[model samples]
Target chain A: MADHQQKSDKTVHRHEALQKKLALKEERKHHNVSFIMMILLTLVAFYAISSDKIGDSFAVMFILVLAVVQVFFQLYIWMHLSHKGHEFPIWGMASGILIAAITVASLMGMIWTS
Target chain B: MSTHASHKKRTGLMDWLTTVDHKKIGILYLLSGGFFFLIGGLEAILMRIQLIKPENDFVSAEMFNQLLTMHGTTMIFLAAMPIIFAFMNAIVPLQIGARDVAFPYVNAVGFWLFFFGGVLLNMSWFLGGAPDAGWTAYAPLSTVSAGHGVDFYVLGLQIAGAGTLAGGINFLVTIINMRAPGMTFMRMPLFTWASFVTSGLILFAFPALTVGFFLLMFERVFGAHFFNADMGGNVLIWEHIFWIFGHPEVYILILPAFGIISEIVSTFSKKRLFGYSAMVFATVLIGFLGFMVWVHHMFTVGLGAVANSIFAVATMAIAIPTGVKIFNWIFTMWGGQIRFTAPMLFAVGFIPTFVMGGVTGVMLSVPAADYQYHDSYFVVAHFHYVIVGGLVLGLFAGLYYWYPRMFNRVLNDTLGKWNFWLFFIGFHLTFFPQHWLGLMGMPRRVFTYMSGQQLDTSNFVSTIGALLMGAGTIVLFINIIISASKKNIASADPWDGRTLEWAMPVPTPEYNFAQTPLVRGLDALYVEKTAGNGKMTPAEPVGEIHMPNGSILPFIMSVGMFISGFGFIYANWYAAGGGLGIVLITMFLRSVIDDHGYHIHKEEVEADIKGGRA
Candidate 1:
């Protein structure tokens, strides 16, 4: 009975190890995809800013959009914000961004322009 | 790190100076905060005496200005903020079933920084003069003010504000990460929930003040052009930034007060807080809205009609969440068995008093009306109604409610009641007539008024009332001293408290719980009493407890900051460099040192439990 139990334990360990390996591979795939996408977005932003075809105003807006997207990729893939137990960090970041945006917009509009 | 010699706790003054225990630090906050409260109260009484009769020269105009600035700064920053911190440090961890704050070292650092910073600010009285540019310290006036008074304000608040920010982050992390098993976010007591939101407000709000202070400091010390309009800097920017921080700061003060009232009212009424989830929702909503309504403070700044309307609406919208809270408190006591403990009286008093403040607040929120009310005695009446009537009363309630937990003695009930009535009635008498005085064209921050303006009677009444309030405060001090001296120990569950904090043994152990409590539901202790065994189930088996070692480093670091503040104020480079060097050296030492902390062994914990001291 002891021998049988040991064999079953070994099997469970092996199964878990295999599962971990597969999950690691999947995570690597996701990271690589996000990395490539971020690189592409940065290049596109550079093109928009440098290219003669894109207007200055439109390019500024486009690059801003790209920057925001890149930030999400960095947070999710590199910082692992997509992982479990990151709800608090996400809430914190979101609220912080909201407040910062409001403050900048109002201060600029009220003081700088005026 | 695990040396047997480190197992013994330090005692006496050395213990307090080196202590990192949350409870000890809390006591330190309370003691320092109480001291500052007295100083601020004295300043207020002096000002009242000056204003007692028309054309009275009890204090010079310059003296009154300094007194006014120091009074507002001290009461808000030194007294109320630290006292709120006192309760937060003492109660939040126990409520959430945690051994200590998440970063105990940082907690100590925060306290000492605030302490030294307050001392530095007060030291201005003897050194040169207290800041006379008003607590708001609007730009060019502060920038061009003679002497080092404003410099003290800039540096002292900057240092103190850093401490507040550290404390805020510590509480946030503690609440988010340190709850015992089954103590979910939803199950957290109202005070803990309120603290969590207050911490969030502090996190976002304090940085604005820090930036404002830095700009002001640079302009003052380094001759920077940040707030100098002639140097192409706009003075309005200072106002904007100050209010941005200042508005949420009021919430930061009052939210914890709201939480205290909620706890006291519910506990004394023998009921679970009515609309628990709604209360939590309202708290979060209020916090969010607090940031949005900074512009209301600036409505008279002429940001434009559109801006005023938008901010005005946002300001009024906050009333919705505040109303929700007020009704919830009333409903909490609707059908329950209400005990008129001192804490309960304060809580009951808070309900109507805070509502009056809120009513006046809504009245002031109208920008068109604010044009008439701006910088008037009406504004003073409105804020005093909220701050003194709302927050101070709530603080008194918390002191009575949590006295047993902090020290194993209940305050004297009869004396406590006298303290309440005197304070409560005096508060009304003082600020209630200020509204009429404002309407009758009495301005704030003034030394004296003309004799025949119909303001004399109100001013006289207000002065007498201020004296009564001062007397009430004295009564409370006597009550504290008298109660603490008595030998009769309070039971573990004094007042039949509903939350986990009340479940501890009479003299709380250095390690709060002998074993981690497995929280079952909202009002965890009460839930257990009603449905299961009348005790918290142990989440873990008996085990050794690891506690952080007391360190003097936080004290040293704060001393360094205090020195740096002086250096900046006086423009002494060597002092600044030396201070910075001291801080850096301490940081280096802390990084390299490996103090893994000592442990209370399992046997000792078991013995404590058996002795009824855990």
Candidate 2:
């Protein structure tokens, strides 16, 4: 929306903008470890093979567990929940997930018994 | 030039169409929401007329369903939420002494989406039928629901729900990030605190609704087996999800009203809210507990005794917090120099009326007892009391409280008193006897009672009460127009209000504050008035103010969804495809063609501060 005016008030702003740019760059560098871990986790999720072709509900359970863990990582790292800049959104999202889990789980339990 | 502006700084219809100013967007919300509220109110009157006599034939069964659906959906979503939000957007930032909300552009997007979505939902009337499933849109019936009515319900809500969610996020960010310096969270006005919690509830609650809508959409449109009995999908899941959102949604609408009433009572009584901390705690607790107890809506769904018992307890738990709030408001006025200003009268009226609703709610919480009450006129009476007495009364109070700030004129007090009494008496009369009818075994949502059902007399009386209520609503609209045209030109602080918004001039500056007002204490502006500084201290020195230029893109974005909404509704493959194309293309254009927003230079800002007018 601000493309109308061009010149003036550039000197002080330029210095401030440059410092912000550098800080962003350094912050990106600090996040490289988490980025690699997320990729490695995704590869494991896709490649892991289940043993014993018959009735191994255990493997399905294990894979679903891994998928659940991977979802948390995606929420934190990929979805930027781990990033300090998004703390407010992170907590809000966590509250939503908690409530949703409770509703779905309790309903599922009711359906199972009935 | 367009109707609202001349060759103004931001000229052209395109300006407002695309604009991001929170105040302008607030006006749009009011305009759109107000129209739907009228339609909803009209629907209510029509339903009343149909029930006026024994075996009345005024409307067909299908039409009755449509009217009821539109009435509930429009009032709750289009009318009530947006109306309150209109005041919040128009006044909250100004109240907190901030120049603008944190995400001004997204704010515009939110309003446009809501506007367009609302329009699309109503379009169902023209598209053969409006959604006839109750506004709750439960499954089985909705799945078997003939025609494109259910499609409109699913897709229209999906679009509108997106808009509401976006607006929620924007408000949350704004309240968290944009408070003026020295305005600590605790020191914030109760209205701001209420808005903050309402926004938080919106953030969590609305998404569950969106998810439910999608599941419904996929089930209906793509033949997904999400709710199909033969496919092992449980229809009950839909009820659970809807109530999950529906229950919290009541709080989302009411909490703001609670905040407004608190402000009104304290200001009129010449005191602070007597138990401010308790009120705040209660507000937060309501917001939290709103999530835990969606099942209370479904006691008759045969959640066995164990499940029912647990939920019954949880439902009753809401009463503790609610009671604390009611007590606080009453105490706030006790022994004080009570001024029965129009707004204060409404606040005082609210206590007993809402207490009635709360008592019924607690009664409904008794799981065994609810079996008799559920799906009856009793439940109907219960909600109407809460909604009309609590929410509508609070909204009317706010309209009076902030009329001067909104339009630089005071509503006629005599007319306002008449409006209040007519509405109060009419509302109670309309819904009160519903308890008796329910106890007599009258099920709710039935188009008509059989001629010999023994239900005729009560229904007739209810219809008469409805007429009175309808008459009362008319008096309100008349008061508004007459006041707008002929009422006194109110000065700043028209009600001797104790909030930051009152510190601004009557016709506020286009730039809200020249320098943001400094906050030294709670009730920042009132503190200044009492300690005898005639006006607020400026928190910041004057400088350039960055105001987002209104653009037509938001309008286009909303129109895209509107088109897509019809596409989904009619099951027009080509229309659906084309509509998605338009919507996605607009979004892409918005991203790729970035316009670094316009700014009000230091000189312009100073000039605005000098001449405080829109």
Candidate 3:
């Protein structure tokens, strides 16, 4: 699963390389699109934060949502986490998020003395 | 990118100090953990002796508090966790048919960090006082306590916890990426499954402790109050964070113990594990539920009814998965050819003892009921039954079961019997009466009780039991020495073992497998034994094997951590900064140097295979 070794048959190997080139092109397109969208998300976040019409809490939530989307783009495109051999890293991040959520929930719900 | 850099094999102390081999590191873990276990046991004995008679004053109340705190801290952090890691490091790679863990260098670094951290924690005894704020290090009390005791606790655990986190990630990666060709998720041996789940728990859990410790350290060292209620900080935050880590921490210890039991039970029963998939599911469920129930530990703190009820129910729900495991073990033995070896005896013993502990656990989970049991001997007995009766027994079972493979000498069976009976009977006698003592209003962590309170006889009996347990440990130490010198060489598959680990030759090679064994199914070795000749079919032909080079940098890095931790405890900024600088320099050197590891050539591997030596 880690590797797909190329065989020494010339025509077949050339076809395989052609397929890989198409896939790379597709991935590059995705990366470019995500980069543009990420910039747009950041601008939207800035707007939410600076706009006078936005309530303080609403702006915070709006920016937080944008940040999450931006993080997905950054991780999948910039960090190449969308590539193969990234399952365990994804599992780690998901579990960390789960536990962090639990910790924040408990701290907010139960710990305050006031 | 690979190169064959020939180097001389290290011998004696240098071999031990610099070696990145998992086997040697496992033994190092065992030795250090065993040393700390003895220290913790001694502390337990002293506390028991102090409480032997009503109003006994052999040790001062202050001393008793220190002993209690250190005993809990040392046993949990330095002793039990490291011992668990020892078995994991020693056995998991072999069981998975991998040559070594994914990150051998990090593994060495983890071990040394733990060693230095434990040493730093113990140094407090010679310098001033040990941490008297309990293992949990609850806030307010931990914050207000005088001296550098809790500082040691904070800094030492911070270093140790970092090591444990690294270890957890290493195992997670190793198991995920390094299994033999045919090993699949469901086909993995139960011990590996247990270790996988335990590592996940450790990964998700230990960071909470690191965060908690940082807060506590800041409050103590820098006077940045995160825990002191007097400074408008919430003390309850500390409790929440600690138990957030602490609760899963117990599971981290016991889950591997559960794994050990699973292996020993099936091997001794000479059967495939009953409900293997259910067992795996239960193990994972237990690890997941472990985090949800930390609030139960704080039930008596007057969290609202809703909060208490939610956590209470969550706590009780863990018993369902645990119960599934208990029944699976029994079913595994049912109608099978059961051999009552020392390890098997511990596995058999663990079931009922753990059940008793579970019953008490459920009882304590009732928030209303817990008010009475809070800070009482009942709580002590409850946890001891689970920890000592459950985890310790499983560890002993693991030690006994893997002893042949580890040391290449069978421990004297007669001595094993003596050790088991003494320890088993002694453990029960020691903790059983504490339940009644708690019910009779004998509060725990106290130096003594008044005479005629119905606690005297129980205390005495408990002390006697402690002595017997101590004696049993001594007998074990003697057995290890005698057995090694006797040189009673064991066969590779001693006890007709069923796992992939048993497929190896005795004194496992540094490269664990010459040719990675193809794992066909659950009990892969058993499948081969029954279907064909017992040898694993090699997944690949003999080939050059790349192996990691051993370096002393991990050792040096750990020493630097120790110095920095110590410096932080005393507010010595120069020492702290200089020590950290040393660590930074070592890491930089490691990165800049091109230490392309050497390889075991195909000829050498072929020779070993032909000679039946690998």
- Candidate 2 overall lDDT versus native: 0.83
Which ten residues in a row are the worst by lDDT in model 3 chain A?
A: A1-10
lDDT of 3 by residue, B1-614 (tens): 34566566899999999999988888999999999999999999999999999989999998998999999999999999999999999999999999999999999999999999999999999989999988888888999889888888888889988888989989999999999989999999888999999999998899888888888888888889787667788888898888889999999999999999999999999889999999999999999999899988888788899999999899989989999999999999999999998889988999999999999999999999999999999999999999999999999999999989888888878898889999999999999999999988888899988998788899999999999999999989999999878856898988998989989888787898999998888899999999887889999999999898899999999999998998899999998998898899899989998887898888899999898888
Task: Give the poorly placed runs of model 3, Cα more than 4 Å off.
Answer: A1-19, A112-114, B1-3
Clashing pairs in 3: none
Q: Which ten residues in a row have the lowest lDDT in candidate 2 chain B?
A: B1-10
Relative to the real complex, the DockQ score for model 2 comes to 0.41
For model 1, residues B534-565, the per-residue Cα lDDT tens digits are: 99999999888988999999999999999989
Candidate 2 lDDT over B10-94, as tens digits, reads 5667667866777777777777877888899889888888876666799999999999988999899989989988888888888
Candidate numbers sorted by lDDT from highest down: 1, 3, 2
Candidate closer to the true structure by DockQ (higher is better), 1 or 2: 1
True contacts kept of each: 0.64, 0.45, 0.82
Question: Looking at candidate 3, what TM-score does chain B attain?
Answer: 0.99
DockQ of each: 0.73, 0.41, 0.65
* CAPRI verdict (incorrect, acceptable, medium, high) for model 2: acceptable
Task: Please identify model 1 stretches exceeding 4 Å from their true place.
Answer: A1-16, A33-63, B1-8
Best by lDDT: 1
